[model samples]
Target: MYTIGQVAKFLGVSRDTLKFYEEKELVKPKQNIENGYRKYNRFDIYDITTVNFYREMDIEIKKIQELRKSKSIEGIKSLVDEKEQEVLKEIEYKKLILKKLQIVKEDCEKIKQFLGKYTVKEMKPLEIRGEIEHYTAYEEYETLKENTDSLKKAVTLTSLRRVIRFNDEGMLEDKFIIVRKVEDFEKDIEGEIVSHPKCMYTVIEDGRWSTGGKNTDHNVEASLRKAAIENGYKLLGLVYINLLLTTYEDGLERVFLEMYVPIK
Candidate 1:
């Protein structure tokens, strides 16, 4: 038999912790009626050791109490298995978070390099998976503008939006595509997949004017068209416009837009 303080010292726990275990009914030490002192036997030491071990494993006190009452190996194994699954899920979620952080870091670097610059580059063919809207004549701009909000909402629900231009037998169309580079050929997506052919494209970056009265997209497209024509390259498709960044100041909206036009 050992005194409460001796047992606590042997177990590397405080006497109050042992008292808490007793209060929780997880351990019952013998009482010396003459001195009104608690005494722990070998069985009591074993039970205290078990409780300490489970606590180190992060098991709930209630679960440890139930474990002690049942003394079921299968029950303990089940609890450990459930905890393992939860840990695995957390690991996967954290990995996804890290991946997203890396992607955002790269995007920030790219924007820093390309802001307010005009350049031409050869891009590989890209497959965009998302919803699209088709328009034949310029008169449909109002309807297109009206639907832009809902279209943006839908595309942004699951993925970042990259609006791409398409040419279908000389007809102009706009396709909202996922912004991320996806390597997998097969994907579960909400809309039709359109392919942007591998070609040389001129990219121009501009911003909405401080007056909030500029059509940045139209201006950028015209600039790209002029550059392509001057360089003896024919426009082969509709223009692609991507919103890079937006800021508001002094009650005015400023938006940075990138325009891409395929040439050659």
Candidate 2:
């Protein structure tokens, strides 16, 4: 048997936490009446260490006590399983935090280079009246894809969107193409006005913008036109998109889009 001081020295726990654990009927240490000091045997030491291990793992105190008293392997396994899930969830949360931190660090570097910071404002209604050549040419799709990929292979997508906006006088900015947040727009709107020869066809009200994936543009344009017409308004104008923000693959990267009459 060893005194409380010895146990504290061995395990690096404060004498008080140990006493509290004892008072809570956790680890039953032996007592030496001669010196009125709490004494602990090797068995006590082992039991205390086991309890502390569970505590450090964030196991519930009541659950740990239950595990200690319950000799069933199933009970112990259940506790271990719960702790494993908690640990996995914590790891996922930490990974997300690190990803966000990396994005913030990159943004800071951009500011250092006079790359400019982003801001938001309600867009003033702009007039856009541009003609669309039909026959569904995929040239624009190919060019955007090639450019976007090039941006990724080089300085990354962040630098690419900026370069595209600067060079493509044809590029729209600060505009978000608004799409209804329904799960599926195609099946929802009956007799949707899509697949038309009319180039000037949609208008966006309050909209959210997102990164341009090849598959999304046409559907969103079609959804807006239907939504507008369903709301009793004549959908007039070339399908022009407003990029609410230029975000390169990060959450909190502002995104929204609104369709407007394309302005030449």
- For each of the candidates, give the backbone clash count: 0, 22
> Which pairs of residues clash in candidate 1, taking residues 3 or more apart in a chain or in different chains?
none
Q: Pick the candidate with the highest lDDT.
A: 1
Off by over 4 Å in 2: 32-36, 115-264
TM-score of each prediction: 0.58, 0.45
> Model 1 Cα displacement at 35 (Å)?
14
Worst 10 residues of 1 by lDDT: 149-158
- lDDT per residue for candidate 1 within 1-264, as digits (tens), equals 999989988789999999999999999998978998998999999999999998887788988988987857788899888778877877877786687578556656656776655566544334443333433334534433433323323323223334545443433554554333434564644344434443334333333345357545455556555666677766776555555555566656665544556666
TM-score of model 2 vs. true structure: 0.45
**How many times do residue backbones clash in model 2?**
22
